[model samples]
Structure formats: structure tokens, C-alpha cells
Target: MARATLIGFSAVAMWALLALLTDASGSMPPFELSAICFAIGTCVGLAARIFSPPPPVRERIPPQVWLIGIAGLFGYHFFYFTALRNAPAVEASLIAYLWPLLIVLGSALMPGEKLAWNHVAGALLGLAGTVLIVTKGGGLAFDARYGFGYAMAGVCALLWSSYSLLSRRFPEVPTTVVTWFCAATSLLSLVCHLALEETVWPEGAVQWLAVLGLGLMPVGAAFYAWDIGVKRGNIQILGAASYAAPLLSTLVLIAAGFAEPSWRILAACVLITGGAVLAAKSMLFGRDAKASAGAGA
Candidate 1:
């Protein structure tokens, strides 16, 4: 199979896992959910690092590599959470998902990338789909508070894109180290969760299960697959493929019965899928040329 196809499927799988975890979190305290995700993720990362045969050391990574990742991970959670706090879910989601557009803009600053008119149109179409997802069936009537939230999410989106770009700087360092940093950063989140979200322990086995699931999937595994995809495939193609995350997430939500199978949702999925295909087809079609291969855990 083509490398791009594999990357695309794994990326979409991560989004589905995220959506499934959200449904799982319903019975759990948010803290437990957050804690277990980070904690187990840390463990999983450590295990992977210990057992895997090392590749040629990319370079002697300095402490600054970790420091940057730690900071970036903190910003990712901080901005996302604060955005949710400052605005409604719908508006916040719309703005937060704009990270790819931020990527498009940031490409000029990065090496070997350019933003073309096709990129802009693809981004706009994805944004329109996001608006539909965020508003649900309500359409685009947004309040000032929600607008503020969207702006905050916009900030978070840029921060994330910056992090994604910066990730290239730490090539040889195990992804687990960064995941560990992210886990620790959630200490700050843990404190906030205590103060604002209330309660500490998960209520029951069901909640515990939810927490475990989040940790294993999004926190532990998805990123590992993504890192591999970066190494083995085209970065530009993978970046474009990320637009599918939101679309696949919607499908997961529908399967969980949180959302109906509506026409708008269907249409949004079509637009996103088609755009992703356009954006990624080159990497996909030339399978022999860029045959990326990875084992998804």
C-alpha cells in the first residue's frame, strides 16, 4: 500500500479515537480522564523507547530541544482549555481547527514550502466545513463572547502549528520524551481541573476505562504514528491530510449517537475528503517513489 494512504488512515484513526474517548469521558471525572491519559501515555512512551532498536542517533539533542517541546505542549493545552473557557464549544472548535491554515501561512517561514491559491481555497473550504460542524444546524449567528472564544482558538491554532513545525527540530529525540513533557505540563492542567472542574478521583470502573482509553489512543499512540509518518512520507502531504481529523471526528460522534447523520454533516465530510484527496493525491499515487511504511500500535 502507498505511504500516504497509510499516513492518512492512521491520522484519521487518531481523530476517531479522540471522538470515541470523548464519549467515554461522559461517565468519568475530567481530572481522572486527563490524568490517566497523560500518565499512561508516559508509560507507553517509555516502553517504546526502551524496547525499540535505536536508529542512528540523529544528533546529540541538547536540553533546549526538550525545553522547547515542553513549552509548546504547555501552550497547546493552555490555549485550548482557555479558549473553551472564554467561549462556547462551537466557536472554540471552529477557531481551534484553523491550525492547518496557520500552517499554510507559516509555510513561508519554514524551509521548502509555499502557500498557493489552491492551498488558500482548500483552507477556506475546510474552514467553511468547520463552521458547519461548530454551529451544528444553528448556522453562523455568533455572539461576541463566542467570537472572542474563536479568536482565542485562533491563537491556539497558531501555537499548535508552530509546535508542529518546531517538532522537526527534534528529529532523533524519542517522541516519548516530548510526550512525557506534555504529561507533566498537564500538571498545570491538573491543578486547573481541580480548581475549576472539581473532584479528583474517577467515580467508577467505567470512568477509569475512559481515562485509560484516552491515554492509550490520542496521548500514547496517535502521536507515535504521526511521528513515523513524518519520517517516512511527505511533510506537505501529511500537513494537508490533517484536515481530515475534524471530518473523521464528526463521523465518530455520529456513530456514538451524539449527532445525527444530517445532510450538512454529510456535505462537510464530502468537501473535506475531496479537498484532502486533492491535497494528498500526489504523494498517494506515486506509491513506489515515497512508499512510507509504519506499524500502528
Candidate 2:
């Protein structure tokens, strides 16, 4: 349990680096960065596959899983990079953190998953947090130029939330199958990059370092660690802890001199994290109630 918690924390740290790294990805088109980063991740996945064999033929994954998962993964990163490109890193990241809340709400749609009142309440709280962040604490003077980027970040949240729900529906799919997902996302990102952006590699060593760091840490090994932690660790704690990614990322950005800490950001964090805790209360603490309700039904 301790080891799993450590690994989960490490995964969260890696995820926390994503926003800062993406912000440092200067002048690289979003699709281009997506292709390059996922390509590196594909290599990592392939190497993992080589060292550790896949499941037997009887447990082969379906094409639909591949399509849906790859689409979600690729789409999330694509828009994520775009969001960082156009919007403030802290704000964009805070908006994207809405995924966890979305996941809790979306889960109710799954078979046998009930829509508890806390879930709706949490969703509303999260939405309010988003509004606070997006509106800059109700000042109401938003930059229209960044609207597309903000919208893209919202789409990123939806993509990841949907992906997570779909993954729950296909729990039989092995974690090792992420190799295929990396491969497919790499291919799609490549096509998009080639068609939409000019062929330009990282401009300098700093950018190159950022790109490599992103591919290896956030896109590559973080997912592996998360899988291990979720399979072996206290998942409820990890789920709650995952909300810290944006907060940590924002701190890292401020530390790196990219942005300044502000009241609105802190308030948004409070609201979002508070809402996540509220929404997850039943899952974390209401096991007796859940079982009793089920038995009664």
C-alpha cells in the first residue's frame, strides 16, 4: 500500500509537469507536438511490449476499444497543447482539471452506477469553479482571442472523462494494451501534424529538452505508474490525490517564472478540489450505505 501510494504520487508529479512542459513547447504546433511526443511514447510502449509479452490470443482487445481509447487520448493531448498555446497555463490547467468531476458525474450513466445527489452537487460545484476561473472571479472581461483555447480545454476535459468511463466499461482490456493506444495516437497525430502544420522540429535545445521530457515523463511512464498504482494501491486515495495535478502544475509554472499566483486561481482550486471531495464522499466512505441500498433493491 505504501509503495502504491508512492507510485501514485510519482505519477501525479509527472502529470503535474505536463502543463509547464507544454507551455515551454515554444513555436511547436499543437498537432506537431502531439505527434512527436506520442511517437516517443510509442517507442517506450513498444519497448515495454518487447520486455513483457502481451495477453494471450483469447484475450485480444476489440477494435472499438482501440478506436475509442486512441481517439480520446489523442484528442485530449491535441486540444491540451492548443489550449496552452493560446490561454494562460494556470487557467487552462484549472479548467482541464474538471475531468475528475466529469468522471464522477459520467459514471452514473454506466450500468449499475447510481446517480447520487452528491454527484450532481459536485458537478455543479466544479462547474462553478470553472466559471470562477474562466470569468476571472466575475470581472466578466474575458479575452475573446483565447475563447477557442478555453473551449479546447473544456473539450479536453470531456475527452478524458469519456475515455475514463469507456475504460470502466471495458475493464477486461489489459493495461498492457496501452501500447496499441500509443501507437494509434501517434499515427493519427502524425497525419494531423503533416496536414495541418509546417514541418518544423524543436527550434533549440531548451525546446528539445521540453519535448523529450514531455514524451518520456508525462505521456510515457506516468500512465504506466498510474496503472500499477490503481491495480495495486489504494485507488480511492489516488483518485482524490489526482486532483492535485493542476494545483501542482500551477505552482510549478509560477516557480518557473511563467505565471503569477492570483486569488482567482486559488479560489478555483478550492472550489474544484472541494467539489471533488464532496462528489467522491460516497465512493470513499459510504460503502455500507451502498451495499444496503443494493441489498434492498
Candidate 3:
């Protein structure tokens, strides 16, 4: 559990760089960037599969699961890169972080999971934080310029939450199936890029580094580590812990001179983290108390 927790945290740390990397990609269309990143990830996945021992043939993955996985892997990155292009990274990241809250809320739809009040409250608080960030602490004038981008970020959050929730329904499917998901999305992204976007190759070390960084971390290895954490560790802790990514990412962006620190970002951080903790507190801590009580009695 401890190892998985550490791995989960490491995955989050890798993810923390995603916003900055996406922005650093420089003028590459979202579709093109997504295609490139997933292409690299596909290669890594294939290589890993080739070296690893094969599992039982009986654990056949269903086509429906394949469809869902592809949709999720493709949909999330597509919206995410587009959001980064359309909106400020700080705002886009905070908004994108809403997935944890959504994940908690969406879990109610799962069989054997009831809708809890704290979860609802947590989601609402997170929503409030998103509003604060989008409104720029109520200072930004109403305009269409970045609204679509913000909306795309919202969609990114929704797609991810939906993916996470649905993933819980099929524990039989190995996480390695994400490799196939990557392959499908890579192909889809390439088709979209060729049809709709202007291709721009990375021209310098910094730009190429951004491309490589994203392909290796956020899109590739991070997913594998996260799968281990969620499947092997205490998920509530990992889920709540994930709220740190936006804060960490924002700080990195500021440190890189890509963004200026602001009260809005700080407020959003507080609200989102607080909300996630509140939502997951029962699963995270209440189980421990129950176990203690059982042992004492």
C-alpha cells in the first residue's frame, strides 16, 4: 500500500507538469500534439507488452470496454490540450482538476454506491472554486474569447470523471489495456490532425523536450503508475491526494515565469483541496476508525 501510494504521488507529480508542457508545445494544434504524445505512448506500451509475460487468454477484454477506454483516452487529452491553448494554464488546470470531485459525485451512479451528502457538498464546493478561477476572482469581463476554452476544460473534467467511474465497473480488465486505448486514440488523433490541423514539427531543444516530456510522463508512464496505485493502494487517499496537482502545476508555471501568482489561484486551490478532502474523508479515515472500534470491542 505504501509503495502504491508513493507511486500514485509520483504519477501526480508527473501530471503536475502537463499544463506547462502543453503550453510549451508552441503553436502545435491540439489534435497534432495529442497524436504525437499518444503515438509515443503507444510505442512504449507495445514495447512493455512484448517484454512482459502474457496473461491468461480467458481474461478477454470486451469490445464495449475497448470503446469506452478509447473514448476516454482520446476525449480527455483532446479537450485538455485544446483548453490549454484556449485559456490561461492556471485557470485551465484548476478547472481540469474538477475531475476528482466529479469522480466522487459520479460514483453514486455505480451499483452498490449510494449518493452521500458530503460527496455532493464537496462537488458543489469544487464547482464554486472553478467559478472563481474562471471569473478571474470576478475581475475578468464577460467575453467569448476564452469562454469556449474554459468550456472545453469543463468537458475534459467530465470525460475523465466518466472514464474513472466506468472503469470501476470492470475490475476484470487489466490496466495494461490502456495500451490498446492509447493505440486507438493515437490513430484517431492522427486522422483528426491530418484532416483539421496544420502540422508543426518541434524546432528546438525546449520544444522537443516539451513533446518528449508529455509523451513519457503525463501520457505514458504516469497512467501505468496511477493504475497500480488505484488498483493496489487505498484509493480514497490517492484520490484526495490528486488535488495537489493543480497547485503544484500552478506553482511550477509561476516559477518558470510563465504565469504570475494571483489570489484567485490561491482561493481555487483552497476550495478544491478542501472539497476533495471533505468528499473522501469517510472513505479515507472513517474506515480506519471502524476498524479500530472493531478491534477494541
Candidate 4:
């Protein structure tokens, strides 16, 4: 439970940093930014290896691991940025938080974990919370931008689900290898963004600072820390804890002046927090922290 709490906070902090950085870099394309972060992360990973790398991170991996995971990762980052860049943060975040709910069905259908009624109930609560945010604490109609943000977020979630289900096949692989894959897939995203969208480099120091933050904090430092937490803890703990990220990021946005404080955001936070708590309770009953902590293996 404590580990989950820590991971949740950590995820929130990372997302908050990510939101601030992106907002800082005005009109910086997501894929190009992704390429920057990935490129920087690759360098960091390489340097770590040179200094004190983990032993070679390969084993007998199924061919499908690379094929499925690579494609899904590529799609997830691409769509995630598109949604963030095109829509409002609060809107995009609420939509993206649907991932935890999606994971229930994901576990049942694709990964073969049964989806229970409690899961449905929790998801509904979370959904309601998001609706509250959209309405600004009451009732608001969905607009095109909001609708598109959700659609993009949905795609991101689906891709993430695919990646999650497939990651079971590559348990022994090293973090550096995973980082490499992220960098590799991100290159495709960069190409796609350049082809489909306006690509621009940061012109001034502010934009450059944003880019640096994306690479160092969001992509490099935070991701590396997340990997450390996951490796040290359980996937259930990591996943459940991660549901708190949206709430944390929203607060960060408000603080950074990128988003205004509103009841809707607060409502969504409560809903996400409460629902995640319920899910955590279920996991607690099923498995102890020490037990679940080893779930990654």
C-alpha cells in the first residue's frame, strides 16, 4: 500500500513536470519533442551503461514481444502528444485516466483477468468524475475539441493496453533495452509528425528550457525513476498508483498557470482518487503488498 502511494505520487510529479514543460514549449510538435526526449534518454541510458550498466538485458524473447510492443509504443506516444497538443489539459487528462478502467477489460479480454462488477462500478464512478470536470462541476456538452481529445486519448489507452499485455513476455529484459525501444519507436513518430503537422524547433531560451525539461525531467529522470519504482515494487501497485497521476498533473497545471483551478478538476480528482482506492482495496484483499510487489516478475 505504501509503495503504491509512493508510486502514485511519483507518477503525478512526473506528469506535472511533463505538463509544465509541454506548455512552456509553445507549439512544439509532440513527435519532435518525443524525439528530443527519447534521444536524450538514449544518451542517458548509454552513459549509465558505460559507467555502471546492468548486465546485458537479453534473454529468449518471443518474436511477438518486439513486434507488438514496438508498434503499440510507437502509437501510444504519437497519439498522446497529438491529444495533449490539440486539446485542453484537463480534458485530455480525464479522457486518458480512462486507462485504469480500460485495463480491467484489458485484463479480462486480452490478458485473461476476469472483469468483475466492482470494476465496472469503479469505472463508472471515475467516468462520472470526468463528466463533472467537463461540465465544470455540473453539466457541460462535449465540443469537437473535447471529443477529439477523448478519441486521441482512447487510442493512447488502447496502445498502452496492448503494450502492457505483451510486456509479460519480456520480463528479464533490462531497462536500457526498453529505453532503446522507446527511442526507436519515437523516431517513427517524429517522421509522422513532420509529414502530417507543422514541425518547428524552439526559437528562444524559454522554449529551449521546455525542451530540456522534457528530456531531463519527463523523459529521462522521471521515467528512469518510474522504472526503478516498478522494478522495486509490483505491477499492480505501480499500475494502481499511477491512476493518481492525472490528479497530480492537474494541480501542477494550475500552479504553472497553464490551467485554471476549477471545481471540475477537483471533482475529477476525488473520483479518480476514490475509485483507485477501491481498486487498491480489492488488490489488498487478494494479495498482500509484499506478494504484489513481486508481481513484476
Query: Cα RMSD (Å) per model?
Result: 3.7, 5.5, 4.5, 4.3
- Which predicted model would earn the best TM-score? 1
In model 1, what are the clashing residue pairs, if there are any? Answer: none
Which of the predicted structures, 1 or 4, would earn the higher TM-score when compared with the native?
A: 1
Q: Write the per-residue lDDT of candidate 3 for residues 174-259, one digit (tens) a residue.
A: 77888878888889999989997888888788998999889888878777677666555444445556666666777789899988
* Cα misplacement distance, residue 178 of candidate 4 (Å): 1.4
List per-prediction Cα lDDT, in the order shown. Answer: 0.66, 0.72, 0.75, 0.63
| lDDT of residue 54 for candidate 1 | 69
Which TM-score value belongs to model 3?
A: 0.78
Runs with alpha carbons beyond 4 Å of true place in candidate 2: 1-13, 50-58, 78-98, 130-157, 224-243, 282-297
- State every prediction's TM-score relative to the real structure: 0.83, 0.73, 0.78, 0.75
lDDT score for residue 140 of model 3: 39
Off by over 4 Å in 4: 1-9, 51-53, 56-61, 80-97, 109-123, 138-153, 221-240, 282-297
* Model 2 per-residue lDDT tens digits across residues 151-236: 98899999877776676567567667776777778788889888878977777888899999988989877766765554444344
The CA lDDT at 140 in model 2 is: 46
What lDDT is reached at residue 227 by model 3?
66
